[model samples]
Target: MIAPPSPVPDSKISLWTPFTFSLFRAIWIASLVSNIGTWMQNVAGVWLVTILTTSTLLVALMQTATSLPSFLLSVPAGALADLTDRRRMLLFTQGFMACMATLLGTLTLMGNISALGVLSFTFLLGMGAALNGPVWQTITPELIPRPVLPFALTLNGVSINVARAVGPAIGGVIISYFSPGYVFLLNGVSFLGTWIVIYSWKRKVAVSSVPAENFIGALRAGVRYVQYSPAIYAILIRAFSFSFGASAMWALLSIVVARRLQLDSSAYGVMLSWLGAGAVSGAFTTGIINRRFTVNQRVLIAIVIFTGTNLSLAFFPAAYWLYPVMFLSGMAWLMIMTSFNTTVQLNLPKWVQARVLSIYMLVFQGGMALGSVTWGTLADHFSLWIALVAAAVWLLLSAFLAIPFPISPAENLNLTPAEHWPEPTVQGDIDPDDGPVVVMVEYMVKVADIPAFRQAVDQLVRLRLRDGALRAGVFTDVTNPSRITEFFYVATWGEHQRQHHRFTKEDLAIETRVIHFHTGSVPPRVTHYIAFPKAPNVDIAPPFENMEGQS
Candidate 1:
């Protein structure tokens, strides 16, 4: 039978709009299986560690084992994602995780696994996840149209929550009847579905004739972009603070199930499923939330609700009370996470998308890693109830961070590369690898417009730095006040070329506003300069000879 047609874009788009595309649908379905297996593995891994050691620190360390890799490797992985074939990267990461899970299972089933062994294998699995995170995040926009991106992200969250609702309970059953080893084995096997789907489908790579950036350069560029982007860094700060505070639930919930509630693994899984159920419910109502609340408002509301969930964990301790509380926690998590993630995705340009995303993942996962250890330590020394209470208090306090670093909307600005810049003219052929390139734009501004021009130039400085400029400056002519020259330095000729292509419509708009201050009958005069190394009788080989062979 023929498959149903994909959803058409119109007013009031449905969350399932992304599912209409065959590839997104297939990947989404496969992700459900993989996520289910992952959640199952999580339940098993934590349960295995908890069973092996009665130490609350060791139990909490399970989360640390899983999260720390993402904390360390996300930025490099993100750079790799942007620099390489994302589909192949996804395949490799999936296969790697499968192997790690299978080996962990084999060892566990043989009764050779120790607490250290479980944490070690979980760390290996986390490495695979770290490598996978950014590439997977970057691919969705390519798979579907832009208008449906928000829905796609929401559905992706739904997929995880759906798996969350079911996976842990099933994992608990497997753990109760079979063993944690079986859960690991099942998780390993689950990755094959996604691998197979990815292998069968073809992915189109964007063609670029410009020399590809070195890994170090890419990392630096990524950092520079985020360094100057207030909107992005604001999100990063908010995300880190939220993750740091919210991680208490993830780190200590299993312990609470065992000690506080006096429940078996199955009941622990059930509690988690309630959390997932709440998230799933929250995912459906996001459209309503979007319409009624601002991004900051939504985030604040979620944080408040999540604080209540933490208080519930500390004070209630009963399963019945936790059922709805867990649900609320899940909803809160979905709101906060989805808000941060979706905002980043919407604001990014494709060139540095994965790299910035990697930084985002780094901050996000780093917060969780550090927070897990912190809360765990608190639990071990003081009490689990105390840890939960402190986390609740911290979460409430973190809400105040939103006031100074509120997230901005990106719907007004177009981020697509405009390619508006024409190739620069040169008197002779120049080496792409030749010394630092300096670009200067000279404009004649009226005395009155100098103040306004300087205001616009301030914005232009950030745009230059965000694109690739190492240093940017504005100089006024000593003799003629109207002669204002703006200059920026880039590392190399090739990098400068890449910077030309990196300008998005938003950036061009900023440039346009800056140029509006120029009162010259003609447009601003632009010039390029490349540095030459000073040497005495040095046999200077043509730079192009070496640069030609370089990638």
Candidate 2:
């Protein structure tokens, strides 16, 4: 008799969910109003500072104040967010920000505000934003299911770019027509609308965690987690590059439009609008990624698309072509940012979710902050187009850096490339009898050694768990697979111990199987990770079952 077909995995991630749409709409509204104020404040603030101090250093310092909180305290706040009620935390932050904005407006109306006063209020706003940033991210998955989590994340990006494009024009108009203080009042009032919506809502999941008692200990823990992780580290570096290389353009874009393109304010506004349209288009386009390519391929594609866009911006002939070029660049930005964010959500565990996000913010937007200042300085000396060209060259260089490390995308037991696999995913402080942490590492391994390596890997797993600190195992490939494709896998340890830790030499024997097994005539290419899903089901694998109480 013919055998029945094996069960196929369920794979339908909704692109259009009510929860997703509501969250997107709410955030877009919030951003549109507040960002308009923010942009107006940014433009007016810088110009105000320039008029007051007549010093670029003073203006630079003012801009830096806006981003300082993210650099200084996102980690601790992230740990705090993971420990407390995220929504409640956000409520407090939002309310505080409104008060700060109101005060700034009040001072401006009284004509009593100074550079120092501006700095104080801006720093307060940054503090609230640091708290809001982590919550904004980690809270989303709780609202929408995992399947649509990516869609929601992409939508989140769409809202930000829309704000980036539109907020400035409105800000400029309001500031020019009335005074800048009116813009601040608009932001203060806008918070009430968001607050009402949040209060009326009911959540489907509890998006809170027990606070880590040792605050510094928790901070160190977050750092060490990425330090030991290859895939996580690689992604972090990619974010850093994007921030440093590509993001500098934002600072110079206004200058380019004003001087290089010799465009008037209205023309600049039109050009900016094209960016939002491009980003929205790119956001929707990524839904097909699951159907067409692996995560690595999408990453590579994002890099190429962004790099090409930047190159076009660097070489555009006339001011007329600027709109079309900026539009495509916006699209490219969405593709890169969304794909990277999805990778973060796909690869992390709930326990460390906020911490990873904190790091992502530190690297990505932090890099932008760094780039902005750098570009501003560059523009004072060089022309804006020269600055844009310099930034474009750096963008191309960063993408090329990623080409060497291509993490394979086969979700299985052994995900790392053969030689460079880190063993913590298999045997570490984490409890294995409980389950595996699915880490994604990108490295290189050889093609010819597939057969013998598979045999050795099978041998390692069959061996009983080692009694020492390292307890390791490996699963062989179901298919021989591509010659040099990136691999993804699930690695299990019974528990992740947070207290004091120790390891013995006995842990090394079986743990080294994947590295040593590739004995072919040539070396193999590979990359791997030990991933921790945001919400892990302990029952799916009995190993994770016993781990519930250990940590």
Candidate 3:
């Protein structure tokens, strides 16, 4: 017999706990090398655009090209990740990006690269990243236990920032001595490590009785989940708002270094490194931040720091002062991003994990894409300072949004699948496609408890709608004043079955509370009905017309 799993550790767990898992450690190291190469390419690509054109719009367009695919494709990609074998999907995307990076390098070396060509290649790479993102995010749970997931995400941030700290600086040195072609080539080669790691791993496949969801249906389910989840949508709003305002620095940093500070590409790389270094520092402190403050408070602090960084770029524009400010900016980015990521991850169950994450990717990247163009246009028409100042002001205003959409912590939630719903009894082998399925639960509530019952059932209504109910309602019997019934409709027999798997301990608790108000002699009665079948060749007579007492 298999040994029982170890008990989960406490809240004060070390930040490095995830590294104890060898698979996680191996994957993390491989991903680090790949991320470094990607960062190097990012530095080279952005600087190359500056060399090709003086137009601020063209330069900012580079950032847009990188973000736009994710904005457009993340939802579909999420659905695909959930529906397909994620390991294979990740392998394909990594290989695709490696080839694209190689081709870009070759083109640059041939002296045939243009502004549009660079942007086009960047867009292709962005598509690969877009496809890779959701699968990559969802894989952490497989690598380590849930208790360590938050820190694992923090460590993921560390990998990116450590690469950020090291990559741009190294890319700068390479560019100073050689051509960007070499940097691109190195990036192409870097994917080998991660590609090999993923290929070597043996992934466990889960066996389930429920059939896999179709693409369109999976997409709809994900969208529906987000529609009713207030905590999640609040996180999305904050993510979009933060990225929208703060993207100015990323979109225009090259121009700021070249035009305002009169610094070389090497200095530009150094500035980015400082930002990365600060982020690396911040990653270690996230555990402390989590212990010390709420998610909303952490995000608020990050916004304040980021606003300061933008204001410094707008007003100071001095190299001496900016080194530290950029460092602070990195820390701010790490704090807020990890907080959003961790909260979202903790709140999701295994089934919908990738799909919802893809939605998060859509909002986060969508915000950056739109914001880049907005800030770039402002810079092109007016001045860089005006753009920076405007962005800083907007970021400051984003802090107030927290008041209305405060983040709810996921620490207390029990997201493990409840699987408590009993199998619905049926007379025949019901086709999964048969629908629409109607579910009714009869409850006996006395007049004295109707108000309390209604209030509790109201919460139940949201729970039903959130987990796949197409429509739901509460009704009272006209002849029997004390008899009340709650009804809901699912789109298909299969969907109703899937909904059985969607409930968590938290959801069951809400439902249990609603059930507590029932005054019936027996437990609430549940009944299921399917839509009447139509026979094309035969005429059907109504059963009620043949009743014995019928007139």
Candidate 4:
């Protein structure tokens, strides 16, 4: 046996490529102006409500109005991104937002603004945000290649944190010297710069042609894809849980510092800056700390660290300690979020990358919306510290609870197939007589177990085929040296149902070799079918055996 020397990787193949940096710069600049405006509006709006209304409910409700759109609109928006040109769609949304911002600025400047007007505008902004949020995430993969995709996403977080730090600080001063009305005006103007830059890009993003009429059908496909993929589902769950549990501070942080810590609004802004600073640092550190970790591993670690660090803030006693706590919280959160972004971009096929990412944005942001309302209510009733503490606990609890769904490789059911596995009939619009139904399910398996698991998983696939069940099954994306996703290809409703209903000693035998070598990973969430158009008509009955009834 000959021992082979390890080959050295090319240094020129560095993660920070020119294209990524350019796109990053453009997006960063755009986000910078927009984010500052966003933060300014956020701070001023919440403060205005707290000052004018005695009820904390009103203050919390104001926060609710801002983020609720994400919950309602993220997934559908993602499907739209897939169906249409994401860049053009973003332009429209940005215009909507700019108009809304300008309107609010005009009314505020004229001294004609009422609380109801503010609330109404808040909903309008939410509407724009909901439309924008999902598509925004999907755009990243189109901007960068696969290897440097992580770096690009990390760069994004770094940029956002920079804005988070600076925006509030500047907004505080502006609001102090001028008025919250001016923040709206500044934000409105900022949109034009981004719009111009995007419009001016020499090369336009090119994607496959999608028909205008297939909008509803495309949406159903994306949703069906999500439902069938356990890895994707787990990713969404991890994201949603992480966002829902950890977002408590987003709403209450200002109130906590201003009311509880007895700090001025400027000081509160400074503290937020510190948090953003931590987040930026965290993003940079991930590039170094994460040597060869898979995206899922990094995501899991980030969530744990972010949740843990934020919890520390709740227990800290001194006001001076607040800075350190907020900073660490930001840092850890940056790691988790950047990891999540990179994972989604890397795993999804270019064809539907934006669409899946958009769904991700919806679930997570919607979680944020609910978290704001829930934590805000809790903070109003209980002590701010108690609310923060509870949020941390929920975050911690969620990590463990969410681990079982095959989000990462560390959990049980660690097995990966050599090829894409077949799933049941998932695509609703397509009939059984059409083509095969495809569903990708990610799983983690030990490196040693992969060979045996391949056979084991194959047996499972063949069982469905013999029963006249699964049409096709293959491995799609392997998470690392250890984990892989088995994409199932089953055709029709009968085969789909049959695969789930019957498993005997014969079916169990193949798993033995697979399990012997297996460490463990999460089991794939079986999906019936993913919606893709093929069978347009259903009236012509083949009088095929009732596979559905028998299965």
Clashes per candidate (backbone, < 3 Å): 0, 46, 0, 31
- Candidate 3 lDDT tens digits, 286-358: 7788889999999999888878878888888488889999988998888888899989988888888999999
What is residue 163's positional error in candidate 4, in angstroms? 1.5
Provide the RMSD of all predictions against the true structure, rounded to 1 decimal.
5.7, 12.8, 3.9, 11.0
Computed on alpha carbons, the lDDT of every model, listed in order, comes to 0.88, 0.62, 0.88, 0.65
lDDT of predicted model 4: 0.65
Task: Tell me the tens digit of each residue's lDDT in model 1 across 1-551.
Answer: 22333445467477777777888899899999999999999989999998898889888788889877888899999999989989899999999999999999999999999999999999999999999999999888778666677678888898988987778779989999989999999999999889998887677778997779989999999999999999999999999988988999998999988998899988887888888888889888887887788889988998888788788888894788889888888888888788888899888999999999999988887898789889999999999989999999998999898778989986556888889888887756666777598899999999988898999999998989998999999999999999999999998888999988899988888899999989889999998888756222345666686788576
Candidate 4 lDDT by residue in tens digits, 1-551: 11222222335434355233465567767877787678777776666566556876777688668866767777677777766777788889888888998899888878888676777788889888888877777666555544555666777777677777677667778878887788888888887777776665544554322223256645655665566555677888888888898787777777777776677877776777788788877765665655666656666676676566556556655568778877777877887787666655554544455667888887777788789878888878977777877887787778675548555432122122222334333323444344465655455677766776787777655544433333546563533766566556755443443334333343355544544544555454444443444544334554567556764
Could you tell me the TM-score of candidate 3?
A: 0.89
Error of 4 at 543 (Å): 15
Better of 1 and 2 by lDDT: 1
TM-score of 2: 0.68
Tell me how far candidate 4 lies from the true structure as C-alpha RMSD in angstroms: 11.0
lDDT of 1: 0.88
Superposed model 2: Cα runs more than 4 Å off: 1-14, 18-37, 47-56, 201-212, 372-390, 407-551
Off by over 4 Å in 3: 1-8, 43-64, 103-121, 172-182, 252-266, 380-383, 534-539, 542-551
